[model samples]
Target: MSYNFKTIRPVMPAKDMINVILSKTQRKTPTVVHPGYDISRIRGFYMRKVKFTQETIHEKIDAILQDFPKLDDIHPFYADLINVLYDKDHYKLALGHVHACRNVIDNIAKDYCRLLKYGDSLYRCKMLKRAALGRMCTTLKKLTSSLNYLDEVRKHLSRMPAINPFERTLLVTGFPNVGKSSFVNNITNANLDVQPYPFTTQNLYVGHTDYNFVRWQVIDTPGVLDHSLSERNPIEMQAITALAHLKACIMFFLDISETCSYSIDQQIALFKDLKPLFKNKPLLLVMTKIDIKKFEQLDPIDQQKLQDVIQSENVFYSQLSNKSGEGIAQVKEKACGLLNEWRQNLKPEQLTGGNPNLLREESILQGVYIAQPKRVNQNRMPVIPQVIGKLNRPTLKDVQEQNGGAGVFSFPLQEHFLLENPDWKYDAVPEIMDGKNIGDFVDADILQRLEELEKEEEMMDQAEIEDPEEDAREEMLLNTRDQINKKREMIKEEHHMKMKQQVKLHRPNLEDAKEDFAKKGIDTTFLEQRAQKFAAKKVLQKQKRQQQSSDDSDDNDMDIEGNDRNQRKGRDALSRSRSRLREISRSRSRGNKKVLTAQEQAMERMSKKIQRRRRNEAKAGDGDTKIDCKMPKHLFTGKSGIGKQSRR
Candidate 1:
């Protein structure tokens, strides 16, 4: 299966990660706090701030680690290939370092949050938050080199060719400048990087084609020099890995023309050096650049070396001139055909008339050939009412001819839609039960009974007529009630309007009151002190209520401890009783004060805030609301420039 790694998330540099953490913390934390605020609220705000920052970093790091492929979870061929490209140990080390940083950041956040929970002042809590964030940023900065390395590796892996090792494949490998890349480009649609210089292709490239409607994979690997396996570099080992893992037809390309600068003897030596890698695989020795020099034109010694390699069993030989595109299709066909035959030979043999348990493999292979299902009643067709013959069916022309063609001819649209027997359409069966039809009952005296019912109905209608005197009395009574209700509503509206005007005139702003008191030589410090004392008392009352509720919960838990596994039932009963008491208290409180709906409450709060802000501005020196007397007329008021072409 070929994989697309493009969807993997992009990695961030260490500096960028630190910047993100700092920016999020500064943007999300509360901007203002005062001594009047509750101490617990202040502590909670800072602790949550630090915890949120740590969580963001943890999520991003975990996403990166999970998105990348794990070596053990992939196919062995891919695992070994990744190991060859980017040393397995180093990759694991990079991920392990990120995991360690994750644990350390979490621990730092937890410790700081615990300290903040018991903080006595806002300044102490703020300092704890700062210290936690500073440590986290410093730790992330240490991963600078590791982050860069992983990002580079991710980019490289995204560009790698997706090769399916399980498919029928043809692997082409040999010395540099020997036309291996050229052969692949000629046969398949793989646009591998090819050049006339040595070592042009330094990585594995793969493409696919179809043979007899079956898909086949074609891999073009880098060329290897005649050196020991241990001394080869990572780029050269790519070829060795493919040769060792992939099950495919191996095509070894050779340049007998000597234009590649590698002698024929050296090319043969390289082939034999990698001979053990080609065991159990169908091998093909391809002679390239035939248009430049034929096999006969080669020296006797060189020709003999090539012949010796081809003489081995299961070894194939072919010639192709890649530049001229000659013998390309023939070589591709022969290689794919041989590969298919070899795969078929590896399949288990078919068994007949033998014990199935002893021949399980053969039985499974033979089970794939299922017999075709046969049809029933093949000799005759059933008489279906809807299957009308063409000759017997009525056409549009026939209907028009019978009804006087273009004039006054109306046809029932559903004439041909009837699927039942023709006689059934007009049958007068009143009811059918259990497939038996019955018609309505008929009696000789039926007309007499109908006449009697109609008379009774007419008599009832005549008796329902009303008297005009009663109607007039009811109408007069309704008119009197309507006039009295209208007069009462008028009185209510007049009273409400007068009360509203009075309230507007009598209400005085808080600032005007303060100024009046000052003119009378009276200090307002007592009022301010009274307000602060009231706020403190309210906070204390809330704390007392919370403490009482917690104590009640503990008592309930202790009561349930003696019950055997039925604690849940007992707790539910206690919760129900407490809930009923709360409901009763809430109803009583609502009855004592005006219970406002959601919309009304929201409007009341908004009005209070607006009035409070106006009062504050009036009492203080009018922070930003004070208007300057001298203003720039041209900037504030001018002919609109939006419609002028010159401005644009």
Candidate 2:
């Protein structure tokens, strides 16, 4: 039954297909290489991809040995790393492989290293006109040049795209287990067991089915492994046919698992192999099981890792759990939206014109030919076949930002990548400044800078309240180095004088003392001077402190010199008064009362001194008068001029 293009019909919810895929899982895993990149561990200034286990090691070592039958020198460590990557789950296994590869790269570099080691020496010898050695040197230069070439190769390998999506024709991609029936399963869902254990969905699957309203066809394609692409599988013919004969888009999916069964590196490899085919298409990686980690622990750091991997902001992630229909509505909505979007943009006029395809509506017949026979007829016009597998004009990946062509943009995206994904603490794109990953940026780092700005603003407040003594101490720090240098010179002079007394034998160099402190990351502005002074000023300080420490030393000296005679007289008076009192008691017994007690005489003397001091203070105050209005006559009119006038 053909329906006219009135409205895009809704397709089955993603859940129905996901359910089929889940049911198929019990069909044992296919035999596949256990990718080492995900299992390895590494600790450094930077994060790295994981690697294989000991099982992988056995396979790789055996493969490498077979690949390079002539190479005799293999490090013993590779054997250990191989075992770890293939069999060991000790997180260090992945790290071991990374180090092993680095070791291999290093070993490969040794030839160049040895040649360059004597480069300066060889050049010098050549300059001195030594004929026999010069020829040897010329040959050495050839060897060095070859070594340099290997160095370039190593650099290229290091930067290797990890994904090699060259000019390949097709990609059979879909999320994990989407009932994405293989090419043969076009009639029924892909349920048959084909590949060995682990890699169960082995053979590349491709199938074509026509969309009723659009007159175009959709091809069902298999999924590409995540992480990295592998070229180990045998080619599928139907998949190749769709690639060569018809333009196709492979839909990639993920089953119900949050983490991939495959390593990230392996998945990347698989993507790479398929990338070039989708040259201009959106490399849309859809997440079907959105509900798996929906309520699970979404740690900020872990989510940040996810964000870094998937550069796109729209979380192409959504779950389609067949058990409970959570993401089915969103999935259906998205599918219909995509299909409708692709349909509205197509021009009946351009159809079978810009694109070259095998089948077409018979109306545009005159100028069109079936297929490119010679693979390069380099002529004739193009034809857009009936609606091809989910084609979108200006796909989301191709959309450019409006203000400037700065980034890939699509307005349909709900969350901004900056908000959705956590960024590295450091620079998103780092420059290797001082041979370090200046790329690692932190939010706290920026926050700290903001804090510094705030602190700077508040510094004046602190400055106003600063203790004058501490300010003086900080000010002292400015000249500390100068003082230290001066003291150092004095110490040197003392040493010289001390040396003068001895016969002129050898003396230790100044370098011996300079090695006392660490120069790495310490801030020594406050400590350096005190450290030096601890030895320099002790003797003089000790003597002065000792003198100051003796309590009443000055008073004792004053007593000896009779400078304290007034104090002594007061004390004598008090003693005499007590004696007089005792004498008075004795006198009373003897009935003698002629003289007054010494206490009364001393009290009168003390009162007279107090009264005299008060009188002197009063006289001093009365002698000075403060006049506000007039200047003194002698000052105002010169006294000498007045005296001359009187004389005249």
Candidate 3:
């Protein structure tokens, strides 16, 4: 039996039986609870007993406007207050509780942090500020950020770290207020942000930690919005541009719970645009905040749904809570683990004597570096064929090592060619003249010279960056590039002319098709002329049909005017026949508004014939065969045709 009616459990009750038992306790008799105040008890009774006046509820609701202004229609907040006043437990105020709810959750979170710091006590009234249910509801409100933190912590615990200088990196990034700030604050340190608002950090801030003693840098860029590099609201393009040439892995943040909540497709599209920036670096899909999910809503972390988020095995799912440091370690470990994996997968950097490499001589730049090139035999490796343009390859110093030396080309041949050339000598050196020996230059002096060249090349390779004062130089380079492009075009034209001449020389009369078009003023070489001719031909044919129709009408009029008795009847019949013909023509013309002339039809036929002839000419072209046409020495050398035949 219980003396306190409010302390009765919801399940273990018969009110009549409890009333009878309470009546028997003339005086209070029971074991006392342990010391330290219980905050939930106070909050629970107040929640059930007290009725908030309209004035007080309105005051609290209006106070939230000062904190978060992104919300619209404060009526929802007012409605929630009314519901609390009237006891409507079913009303969900996800959008309404944005600002006010966070304060409550944070207060409760501080209690947890406090308890963790101090000893747990029943007498610690301040331990659970306001109430436990209030804490649960607030945490419920900020589910996205909370789950994201937890996920980060879990990932860090799962993956171990790699050695220093050999570690790879993953950069988690997104627009400002997308929970990136809270995410960094939760996982790394508890107090990185000075404020909880926009543009809090004016520049790029990098945080480094040695979890498992694996050195790694986590980049927390300043808040970014949905805009291009040059088309930003702030003058600070530091964060967006820093990512322009990154080598680390990327974790694109998507916070759909905010006012600027981007759709999944929009996030995926942004990923695609940013994906190329990383140049095939590993990408992780981080769906932030799992706590705030409403029961009827779809789970944001669902796999099939996330296929639309990022379509790759490189993606990872995480839920984080910055307030509690829920997934901070996991996120750090995941970032480090990815970096380490990439480091291992990175094509082993080539060993060159110029760089004072530990690898043996004759082995530098001598291994296979092809990517997924087909195998032809056991001995022959994938060949980057020595064509005119494809001859440029990564130098020993320029090539980054790739997956176990499968002969995969690590650097893009086009971008890397300007940086270093394997065939170009950095110093003045004698080449293998006609038939001279090549192994006579292996002294210590040559080795020193090579080492110096390697250091210079390494420095220059790293210098492929944006230069500010080179505007005019860049324009000059552009002009030079245009000139080179024109040269290529002229060369292409020369090739075309040569091919045509060779084909015509082999078989005459192929140019007749062009001549036919010229006679008609078609200027077949000019596509515009053909179109105009086709139009004119249609007009001419239409005019001819109209003249013929007028002439037929005149002949019928003459028969009707000069006629005997039978002739007049015949003229009348001819008039009737002409009228019927005119009616039929009108009906047919009405059926199809478009009308073409005879010459237009003929011109179309001619155009098709010309096309067929040109196609046949192309089929027979076979580019010009550059074969040796001279008679073979085995057949005609020192022998007359008659004598050779007689001998055979």
Candidate 4:
């Protein structure tokens, strides 16, 4: 259905199919499964082989079924075409056989695996697995004919044309040797055989050509002989199926020269018999091979024979000489024009314009910039919180106006200290002494000084405005900016000098510490020995602990020997009997392998005791754990002095 039939896989022979399964089984299945492994693990290994092989075979078969298009699902044109080429019943039967084989294989795998599950030995399981694989291979081998037939079908389908039944088409068909193939080759890009013999075009050959910027396909079907439906062969039925199913413009070619062995009367009779297929379709009666003879030059009786076809309503007539290449383009253009007009007339409502938009372009552009009214609820007013309503907050501009209006006035910043002491709402002025009438002295001259400053600024503003020269005003502005910068630089330099003086005043005097300890009558020659004495004490403690452990182990060994000597042969025999009883009881409780005999139990106990003694001896013989040296001799012993050996 996708028009890519070549992607179908080639069928495998029966022998090759079995070999493929066998080789895949060998490659995927593990070679070894030890008996000591859990029983479930062993069963799992064999089950994997059976499932893998079964799935592989199913995949191969299912792929073929899925790749081939279902006849019922495709277009009727293609469905009928396929039926004529390959019998529908036979095709379905072949597919059914392959599917049945797949089911057989699945059943075989399930039955044999069930048997293998309870197999008691490795040999039994392996034999059962072999039988399952053998049965699956045998079943597949029986589907040899079905696979071969499907393979052939795939090849034929791949070579078939990818035709669309719904597209605008021109069905070029007529009696044999009537120049149908010739006309198609001349009009479109199809490589149709132009032989002078009859039935040159056996299968349907499709060609494509563009008319009015729309693609029009031309299908050159095999020539249909004048016969009954049951008498026609598969080749002729191909054309009949197309004519019956394709909703296209029909072009019935006529070899007026009678070179195709069909008389003019015979061609006319065939047209009348198949006229029902041309009903409701745009029909064209093409007069082909005009180079050999003209229709007008024919006898009066022959012209009368074609009168019924040419005089019919909605039927067209054309004269074409494919050999001389005349009237071909005219015929193609006339047919395309009629097809376009007929389609338009079939759906008259489409010509009335189906677009639903009612607005004009100019109106849309004019209304695009108009502002619509904002949607709001008139039923209720917005609510304000109670806490917000209680507060008296001033706008920023109102606060700025109260404090000072730009550069005209400035407010003195007073520290509230509300967190430190709420009672002291006003900042404490350190400059005002106690019992000195603070407010009187602090603000007594403030108004007078402000008036004096205002007078100075007024005088400066009058000077700048009164000056007539622009250059003098510019020079004064530059001089003022330079003076301001110089004052800032001087203040910065004074601050830096003050910081340096502060650092020098806080510097410490370290000359007193330079006096040596010995100069103060202090003795310090024992410092080195004091440090080494601590390390030496730690080493001595570790050595004592090691010696104590060794002594304890020696005493334990002597005690063990004394006990061994005190025991008698009769007591040893009694102990051996008890050990055997213990072994038997442990075996029953644990559900393990055979229990040990009396002699074996005694030997096992002796070996364990000997091993424990040897372990203790090895531990006791180990060197001391004390620290040897902070600095080893090999590292600290430098190259020997130039003339004599130096002791470290």
Best by lDDT: 1
Candidate 2 per-residue lDDT over residues 1-648, each given as its tens digit: 111211222222223322332233223222222323222211110011011111222343334323321212322222222222232243233334333543443343333333333433433322221232223223323333333333333343233112111111123354335434332243224344544234445443323323322222333433444333234223232233233333233344543243546533454445455555544332345443345554244566545645564664332344454335555555434443444344335443332332233114423433355474675757869776656645645654455545345454436443334553444323344457665564464455787899899989798788678588988888899789789999999999999887755578666543433343233332344355665677578877887788766734665656544666656877998999999998867745577554544665676798888679658755445355645548776777744654464210
- Predicted candidate 4 versus true structure: per-residue lDDT over 463-512, tens digit per residue: 87654588788899999999999999999999988775444455433333
lDDT of 1 by residue, 42-79 (tens): 99888888988999999989998997788887767778
Location of the lowest summed lDDT over 10 successive residues in candidate 2: 42-51
Best by TM-score: 1
Report, for every candidate in turn, its global Cα lDDT versus the true structure.
0.82, 0.40, 0.49, 0.78
- TM-scores of all candidate predictions against the true structure: 0.54, 0.23, 0.27, 0.53
- Give candidate 2 regions above 4 Å deviation: 1-197, 203-230, 236-246, 255-260, 263-273, 290-292, 295-299, 308-317, 322-333, 343-648
Q: On a 0 to 1 TM-score scale, where does candidate 2 land against the true structure? A: 0.23
lDDT of 4: 0.78
Better of 1 and 4 by lDDT: 1
Determine which window of 10 residues in candidate 3 has minimal summed lDDT: 1-10
Q: Decide which is better by lDDT, 1 or 2.
A: 1
Report the lDDT of model 4 for residue 343.
Answer: 62
Q: Model 3 over residues 177-199: C-alpha lDDT tens digits? A: 56666666655543567565566
How close is each model in CA RMSD to the real structure?
28.1, 42.5, 41.8, 29.9
Candidate achieving higher TM-score, 2 or 3: 3
Off by over 4 Å in 4: 312-314, 345-648
Runs with alpha carbons beyond 4 Å of true place in candidate 1: 28-31, 345-648
